[model samples]
Target: MPGTPYFSPRLILGAAAMFGMLLALGIHILGQRFGLDLGDLWGTPNGIIPATAAIAWWLIAAVAFVGGYVTASLLFSAASGHLPRRLQHALIAGGLLLLIAAGQAASGPSPVPTLHGFYNGIVALMLGAAMAFAGAHFALARH
Candidate 1:
Protein backbone atom coordinates (compact mmCIF):
# COMPACT_ATOMS: atom_id res chain seq x y z
CA MET A 1 0.00 0.00 0.00
CA PRO A 2 2.98 2.24 -0.50
CA GLY A 3 1.33 4.14 -3.28
CA THR A 4 -2.13 4.36 -1.71
CA PRO A 5 -2.95 8.01 -1.43
CA TYR A 6 -4.40 8.73 1.96
CA PHE A 7 -5.97 12.10 2.56
CA SER A 8 -3.77 15.06 3.28
CA PRO A 9 -3.35 16.03 6.91
CA ARG A 10 -5.52 19.10 6.65
CA LEU A 11 -8.50 17.19 5.28
CA ILE A 12 -8.22 14.56 7.96
CA LEU A 13 -7.91 17.05 10.80
CA GLY A 14 -10.63 19.37 9.52
CA ALA A 15 -13.08 16.56 8.94
CA ALA A 16 -12.42 15.06 12.35
CA ALA A 17 -12.80 18.39 14.14
CA MET A 18 -16.01 19.27 12.31
CA PHE A 19 -17.41 15.83 12.91
CA GLY A 20 -16.58 16.09 16.61
CA MET A 21 -18.14 19.55 16.81
CA LEU A 22 -21.35 18.26 15.23
CA LEU A 23 -21.47 15.35 17.59
CA ALA A 24 -21.03 17.69 20.56
CA LEU A 25 -23.83 19.88 19.27
CA GLY A 26 -26.08 16.85 18.98
CA ILE A 27 -25.27 15.86 22.53
CA HIS A 28 -26.05 19.37 23.69
CA ILE A 29 -29.44 19.28 22.00
CA LEU A 30 -30.23 15.88 23.44
CA GLY A 31 -29.25 17.07 26.89
CA GLN A 32 -31.56 20.01 26.57
CA ARG A 33 -34.44 17.85 25.34
CA PHE A 34 -34.00 15.50 28.27
CA GLY A 35 -33.81 18.40 30.69
CA LEU A 36 -30.28 17.52 31.57
CA ASP A 37 -28.15 20.37 32.89
CA LEU A 38 -25.43 20.24 30.32
CA GLY A 39 -23.67 23.58 30.35
CA ASP A 40 -24.68 26.28 27.95
CA LEU A 41 -21.79 25.73 25.61
CA TRP A 42 -24.08 27.06 23.01
CA GLY A 43 -25.20 30.61 23.62
CA THR A 44 -28.12 31.22 25.95
CA PRO A 45 -31.07 33.47 25.22
CA ASN A 46 -30.82 37.20 26.09
CA GLY A 47 -27.06 36.76 26.70
CA ILE A 48 -27.69 35.31 30.10
CA ILE A 49 -24.67 33.78 31.78
CA PRO A 50 -25.55 30.29 32.89
CA ALA A 51 -23.95 28.35 35.70
CA THR A 52 -22.88 25.58 33.31
CA ALA A 53 -20.09 27.41 31.56
CA ALA A 54 -17.40 25.36 33.27
CA ILE A 55 -19.06 22.14 32.25
CA ALA A 56 -19.37 23.43 28.72
CA TRP A 57 -15.68 24.24 28.61
CA TRP A 58 -14.76 20.73 29.68
CA LEU A 59 -17.12 19.26 27.12
CA ILE A 60 -15.54 21.24 24.34
CA ALA A 61 -12.10 20.19 25.53
CA ALA A 62 -13.11 16.56 25.40
CA VAL A 63 -14.43 17.01 21.90
CA ALA A 64 -11.21 18.57 20.72
CA PHE A 65 -9.09 15.91 22.36
CA VAL A 66 -11.12 13.13 20.80
CA GLY A 67 -10.92 14.74 17.41
CA GLY A 68 -7.13 14.97 17.53
CA TYR A 69 -6.71 11.50 18.99
CA VAL A 70 -8.85 9.87 16.33
CA THR A 71 -7.23 11.70 13.47
CA ALA A 72 -3.69 10.99 14.57
CA SER A 73 -4.38 7.41 15.57
CA LEU A 74 -5.95 6.58 12.24
CA LEU A 75 -3.36 8.30 10.12
CA PHE A 76 -0.38 6.99 12.04
CA SER A 77 -1.67 3.47 12.29
CA ALA A 78 -2.86 3.00 8.72
CA ALA A 79 -0.25 4.85 6.78
CA SER A 80 3.04 3.06 6.08
CA GLY A 81 5.36 5.93 6.80
CA HIS A 82 8.10 7.07 9.14
CA LEU A 83 6.98 7.92 12.64
CA PRO A 84 8.60 11.34 12.60
CA ARG A 85 7.00 12.17 9.30
CA ARG A 86 3.61 11.15 10.57
CA LEU A 87 4.11 13.25 13.71
CA GLN A 88 5.13 16.24 11.67
CA HIS A 89 1.92 15.90 9.71
CA ALA A 90 -0.03 15.79 12.92
CA LEU A 91 1.72 18.88 14.23
CA ILE A 92 0.94 20.75 11.05
CA ALA A 93 -2.66 19.78 11.33
CA GLY A 94 -2.81 20.97 14.93
CA GLY A 95 -1.21 24.27 14.04
CA LEU A 96 -3.70 24.82 11.29
CA LEU A 97 -6.57 24.10 13.63
CA LEU A 98 -5.21 26.55 16.16
CA LEU A 99 -4.97 29.22 13.49
CA ILE A 100 -8.56 28.66 12.46
CA ALA A 101 -9.76 28.86 16.05
CA ALA A 102 -7.89 32.10 16.63
CA GLY A 103 -9.27 33.61 13.46
CA GLN A 104 -12.81 32.74 14.47
CA ALA A 105 -12.30 34.19 17.93
CA ALA A 106 -11.01 37.38 16.38
CA SER A 107 -13.48 37.96 13.56
CA GLY A 108 -16.59 35.98 14.36
CA PRO A 109 -19.54 37.38 16.29
CA SER A 110 -19.35 36.96 20.04
CA PRO A 111 -21.31 33.97 21.29
CA VAL A 112 -22.24 36.00 24.37
CA PRO A 113 -22.42 39.74 24.95
CA THR A 114 -20.46 40.07 28.21
CA LEU A 115 -16.72 40.43 28.69
CA HIS A 116 -16.71 37.38 30.96
CA GLY A 117 -18.24 35.38 28.15
CA PHE A 118 -15.65 36.69 25.73
CA TYR A 119 -12.75 35.73 27.99
CA ASN A 120 -14.26 32.37 28.74
CA GLY A 121 -14.63 31.71 25.06
CA ILE A 122 -11.01 32.58 24.49
CA VAL A 123 -9.91 30.26 27.29
CA ALA A 124 -12.04 27.48 25.87
CA LEU A 125 -10.43 27.92 22.49
CA MET A 126 -6.98 27.74 24.01
CA LEU A 127 -7.91 24.69 26.03
CA GLY A 128 -9.27 23.07 22.88
CA ALA A 129 -6.04 23.60 20.99
CA ALA A 130 -3.97 22.36 23.89
CA MET A 131 -6.11 19.31 24.41
CA ALA A 132 -5.88 18.52 20.74
CA PHE A 133 -2.12 18.76 20.83
CA ALA A 134 -2.00 16.55 23.87
CA GLY A 135 -4.25 13.98 22.26
CA ALA A 136 -2.13 13.84 19.14
CA HIS A 137 0.96 13.52 21.27
CA PHE A 138 -0.47 10.58 23.12
CA ALA A 139 -1.59 8.95 19.91
CA LEU A 140 1.84 9.31 18.39
CA ALA A 141 3.46 7.97 21.55
CA ARG A 142 1.45 4.82 21.24
CA HIS A 143 2.83 4.19 17.80
Candidate 2:
Protein backbone atom coordinates (compact mmCIF):
# COMPACT_ATOMS: atom_id res chain seq x y z
CA MET A 1 0.00 0.00 0.00
CA PRO A 2 2.98 2.25 -0.38
CA GLY A 3 1.99 3.96 -3.63
CA THR A 4 -1.73 3.71 -3.00
CA PRO A 5 -3.41 7.02 -2.62
CA TYR A 6 -5.43 7.67 0.52
CA PHE A 7 -8.92 9.11 0.53
CA SER A 8 -9.17 12.67 1.71
CA PRO A 9 -12.11 14.59 3.18
CA ARG A 10 -11.62 17.04 0.38
CA LEU A 11 -12.56 14.33 -2.10
CA ILE A 12 -15.97 14.01 -0.49
CA LEU A 13 -16.44 17.77 -0.40
CA GLY A 14 -15.45 18.07 -4.02
CA ALA A 15 -17.79 15.28 -5.02
CA ALA A 16 -20.65 16.96 -3.19
CA ALA A 17 -19.88 20.28 -4.81
CA MET A 18 -19.80 18.75 -8.25
CA PHE A 19 -23.06 16.97 -7.63
CA GLY A 20 -24.63 20.23 -6.48
CA MET A 21 -23.50 22.02 -9.59
CA LEU A 22 -24.87 19.25 -11.75
CA LEU A 23 -28.15 19.40 -9.89
CA ALA A 24 -28.38 23.13 -10.50
CA LEU A 25 -27.70 22.71 -14.18
CA GLY A 26 -30.18 19.89 -14.44
CA ILE A 27 -32.85 22.02 -12.81
CA HIS A 28 -32.25 24.79 -15.28
CA ILE A 29 -32.38 22.43 -18.23
CA LEU A 30 -35.55 20.86 -16.96
CA GLY A 31 -37.14 24.23 -16.42
CA GLN A 32 -36.38 25.29 -19.97
CA ARG A 33 -37.62 22.01 -21.40
CA PHE A 34 -40.90 22.22 -19.55
CA GLY A 35 -41.31 25.93 -20.26
CA LEU A 36 -41.51 26.71 -16.57
CA ASP A 37 -40.72 30.31 -15.74
CA LEU A 38 -37.86 30.26 -13.21
CA GLY A 39 -38.11 34.03 -12.90
CA ASP A 40 -40.92 33.62 -10.42
CA LEU A 41 -38.64 31.55 -8.24
CA TRP A 42 -36.19 34.41 -8.27
CA GLY A 43 -38.87 36.72 -6.83
CA THR A 44 -38.86 39.13 -9.73
CA PRO A 45 -41.59 41.70 -9.22
CA ASN A 46 -42.16 42.75 -12.82
CA GLY A 47 -41.33 39.26 -14.08
CA ILE A 48 -38.96 40.90 -16.54
CA ILE A 49 -36.53 38.04 -15.91
CA PRO A 50 -33.29 39.16 -14.37
CA ALA A 51 -30.08 37.13 -13.96
CA THR A 52 -30.97 36.40 -10.37
CA ALA A 53 -32.33 32.98 -11.22
CA ALA A 54 -28.89 31.68 -12.21
CA ILE A 55 -27.33 33.09 -9.08
CA ALA A 56 -30.04 31.68 -6.85
CA TRP A 57 -29.71 28.27 -8.45
CA TRP A 58 -25.98 28.19 -7.80
CA LEU A 59 -26.48 29.32 -4.22
CA ILE A 60 -28.96 26.55 -3.62
CA ALA A 61 -26.52 24.05 -5.05
CA ALA A 62 -23.76 25.27 -2.77
CA VAL A 63 -26.01 24.96 0.25
CA ALA A 64 -26.98 21.45 -0.82
CA PHE A 65 -23.32 20.40 -0.94
CA VAL A 66 -22.54 21.78 2.49
CA GLY A 67 -25.65 20.26 3.96
CA GLY A 68 -24.84 16.89 2.47
CA TYR A 69 -21.28 16.93 3.78
CA VAL A 70 -22.37 17.81 7.29
CA THR A 71 -25.19 15.29 7.38
CA ALA A 72 -22.86 12.54 6.19
CA SER A 73 -20.28 13.37 8.83
CA LEU A 74 -22.85 13.30 11.60
CA LEU A 75 -24.39 10.05 10.43
CA PHE A 76 -21.04 8.32 10.04
CA SER A 77 -19.79 9.48 13.42
CA ALA A 78 -22.95 8.37 15.16
CA ALA A 79 -23.09 5.03 13.36
CA SER A 80 -19.45 4.19 14.00
CA GLY A 81 -20.43 3.60 17.58
CA HIS A 82 -22.95 1.08 18.88
CA LEU A 83 -25.79 2.47 16.81
CA PRO A 84 -26.63 0.82 13.50
CA ARG A 85 -25.59 2.72 10.40
CA ARG A 86 -29.04 2.49 8.90
CA LEU A 87 -30.63 3.94 12.01
CA GLN A 88 -28.13 6.73 12.22
CA HIS A 89 -28.55 7.67 8.56
CA ALA A 90 -32.30 7.53 8.84
CA LEU A 91 -32.32 9.71 11.94
CA ILE A 92 -30.11 12.33 10.40
CA ALA A 93 -32.06 12.26 7.15
CA GLY A 94 -35.32 12.60 9.04
CA GLY A 95 -33.96 15.48 11.07
CA LEU A 96 -32.87 17.25 7.90
CA LEU A 97 -36.29 16.69 6.37
CA LEU A 98 -37.94 18.16 9.43
CA LEU A 99 -35.66 21.16 9.36
CA ILE A 100 -36.44 21.75 5.70
CA ALA A 101 -40.16 21.39 6.35
CA ALA A 102 -40.00 23.93 9.17
CA GLY A 103 -37.97 26.28 7.05
CA GLN A 104 -40.50 26.04 4.21
CA ALA A 105 -43.31 26.82 6.60
CA ALA A 106 -41.48 29.79 8.07
CA SER A 107 -40.52 31.10 4.64
CA GLY A 108 -44.14 30.90 3.48
CA PRO A 109 -43.21 29.25 0.18
CA SER A 110 -40.09 27.99 -1.47
CA PRO A 111 -38.28 30.48 -3.66
CA VAL A 112 -37.28 27.82 -6.13
CA PRO A 113 -40.03 25.92 -7.84
CA THR A 114 -40.07 22.40 -9.39
CA LEU A 115 -40.36 19.93 -6.51
CA HIS A 116 -38.22 21.91 -4.13
CA GLY A 117 -38.57 19.83 -1.00
CA PHE A 118 -38.34 16.48 -2.73
CA TYR A 119 -35.36 17.50 -4.79
CA ASN A 120 -33.49 18.71 -1.75
CA GLY A 121 -34.33 15.57 0.15
CA ILE A 122 -32.83 13.43 -2.58
CA VAL A 123 -29.75 15.62 -2.70
CA ALA A 124 -29.31 15.30 1.05
CA LEU A 125 -29.47 11.52 0.84
CA MET A 126 -26.88 11.46 -1.93
CA LEU A 127 -24.61 13.78 0.00
CA GLY A 128 -24.97 11.75 3.17
CA ALA A 129 -23.99 8.57 1.33
CA ALA A 130 -21.02 10.20 -0.34
CA MET A 131 -19.75 11.55 2.94
CA ALA A 132 -20.25 8.27 4.74
CA PHE A 133 -18.34 6.33 2.09
CA ALA A 134 -15.55 8.87 2.03
CA GLY A 135 -15.26 8.93 5.80
CA ALA A 136 -15.20 5.19 6.02
CA HIS A 137 -12.52 4.88 3.37
CA PHE A 138 -10.37 7.49 5.03
CA ALA A 139 -10.74 5.84 8.41
CA LEU A 140 -9.76 2.49 6.95
CA ALA A 141 -6.69 3.97 5.33
CA ARG A 142 -5.37 4.89 8.76
CA HIS A 143 -5.74 1.37 10.08
Off by over 4 Å in 2: 1-49, 82-143
Estimate candidate 2's RMSD in Å.
10.6
**Candidate 1 residue-wise lDDT, 1-143, digit = tens:** 35756656555555545544433443333333333333354556878767565556566668768866776676655554544666667866775675455454445453444564455545555666666666666666675
Residues 62-89 of candidate 2 have per-residue lDDT tens digits of 4444444554454334434545778767
Assess the local accuracy of residue 19 in candidate 1 as a C-alpha lDDT between 0 and 100.
Answer: 44
TM-score of candidate 2 relative to the true fold: 0.33
RMSD of each candidate relative to the true structure:
9.8, 10.6
Alpha-carbon local distance difference test for all models: 0.55, 0.46
TM-scores of the candidates in the order shown = 0.45, 0.33
Q: Which 10-residue window of candidate 2 scores lowest in summed lDDT?
A: 28-37
Backbone collision tally, model 1: 0
Which structure among the candidates has the greatest lDDT?
1
Model 1 scores a TM of: 0.45
lDDT measured at residue 126 in model 2 versus the true structure, 0 to 100: 55
